[model samples]
Target: MRRAISRLKPLWLVPILLGALLGVLGVLDVVPDFVAAVPPPVIVTAIALGVVLFAVHPRAEAHQPHRMAAPVRGRWAALNTPGQQLPSHGSRFLGQYAAVDILRPTTPATPAKLRKAWRNSTPQEYPSFGEAVYAMAPGVVTATWSRSRDHRARNTWQSLVFMLVLEGSLRSVAGRAALLGNHVIVRHADGTAAVYAHLRRGGVAVQKGQQVGVGNQLGEVGNTGNSSEPHLHVHLMDRANPNAAAGLKMTWTDITRSEEIEPSLAEIAKQPEPNAVLSMPRNGEIFEA
Candidate 1:
């Protein structure tokens, strides 16, 4: 009976104590009648304290482990095309794909405009002069596209007016850069595949059946199929076949660490700062997490 009473006592005592406090407050008029009409403050001190704690908490920092014990003795080729000055960075590739401008250009450039005359301006239909793209990881040449003419340039006002009128029809002829035009796919050591896209027509350095090592020149950057600008696109996937390639979350070794958006050609001209590196993934390359 005592054990049962103990539990029941807590249940009854809370309400009784609350009632007694209310009675006392009513008798003493300690609480103003207007107190019932008041609203709670928008920001609570406890909540503010929690937010401060959260802001100061450390974020999750992840690092990849080096793949190879031996340091890779290779360097990435120059990304700029010969005789073609980059408007900004020495590197042709602009903006991050997955992280920045996921499907189209974010600033200064727009996808609609890029698609209007992509055949010439972008590597979607024509390869850039002397821009050799290489295999970042080894796999296969599962897909390729090399049959499209880059559009002719039009700088005049009349030409610009005409180009806008032809936007609807221009889309039919314009190729997709993100579609991995004129590309090669190779199976990576981790069972995933690496895709090299927007290769120059007739610039494919490797045959359909040839085996390539890390940094082996695969082809020149081209605007063969689907691209908005003269740049090379590389990414990792789970499948070798183009139709089935699934994007894999990946990180590269020797890559610059910073949250840079739309880095220009000039920005890429400088070598990696002391103790800094640009991302390049290759076989036998050690990756430190």
Candidate 2:
């Protein structure tokens, strides 16, 4: 009997279940009048949720670069982007050790994961993470925050669930550290501030008011603050504070170009291969040197 059923496609189960649900609804007399006169928000919501859960649900076919081979050398693990992987120096320090997506790359790992409305996936395009992530034309570390314990992956998920639960509960924020948890804000020579968020706990290698070069190691990556995974979140802003700052226009040197209005996750997952290099903005676009 088991062997006999194995040959069947089992496509009829869907209609059978749907039919049973409708039959139960009819017997309950919930929609005795007009049948279609009123909108069934419950049924509509269930169907919509089912579709979304099916699409974003984590499965074997879903994109997951974390399970891929460690792309970089060293013991530090790298941050993951949509299509590409940035070497964090092979550090498992993020999960057991420490580390830290975009506006929302739309993590399909689970239904409760945050949905990214937009993401900034501009790869620095070098052999390793050390190649770029520059000093932003030189600056001093005006302020730094270290010493937070690296939240385990389980904790990360718990924090995400809490935030999603309270997503619309807050009216506005007067001051919230959740925006930039455990980070360093360096003021560039041109007065532009580069904010690096979700760094490793007690891994900040720099000090307050210390002048450092472009390639100086500030700290190990960690899952601190409001972050989903282990990756350096760098975005230029005019102000030093995360709450009051607006992201600035940033550019890099010696990279390949593939500009998209809205780049897909498939493209970001392909990065970090050995010797894979890419540049942004094409040619002739002069950025702050």
Q: lDDT scores for all predictions?
A: 0.40, 0.40
| Residue 246 in candidate 1, Cα distance off native in Å | 2.0
Summarize candidate 2's per-residue lDDT along 1-289 as a digit string, tens digits: 3222211213322333454466688788774566446467755655554433322211112221221111112222122321222222121111111112222222333222234324321111111122122343467997787755544332234445655575312211211234345678787765557766666666677788999776666765565565444445555554454333433333344232333222223322333444221222211111121
Regions of candidate 2 where Cα sits further than 4 Å from its true position: 1-134, 154-160, 167-176, 256-264, 267-289
Candidates in order, TM-scores: namely: 0.42, 0.43
After the best TM-score superposition of candidate 2, give how far the Cα of residue 82 lies from its true spot, in angstroms.
13
Best by TM-score: 2
Candidate 1, 1-289: lDDT as tens digits: 3223322322433433444455577688786666435442422333444333322211112333222211112222233211112111221111111111011112344233323442334333232333666666655555555554434333334445564576422332232333445666667656656666656667767766677676777777655444444445565444454223333334345433222222233333343333222343221121221
Which portions of model 1 miss their true places by more than 4 Å?
Answer: 1-129, 151-178, 257-289
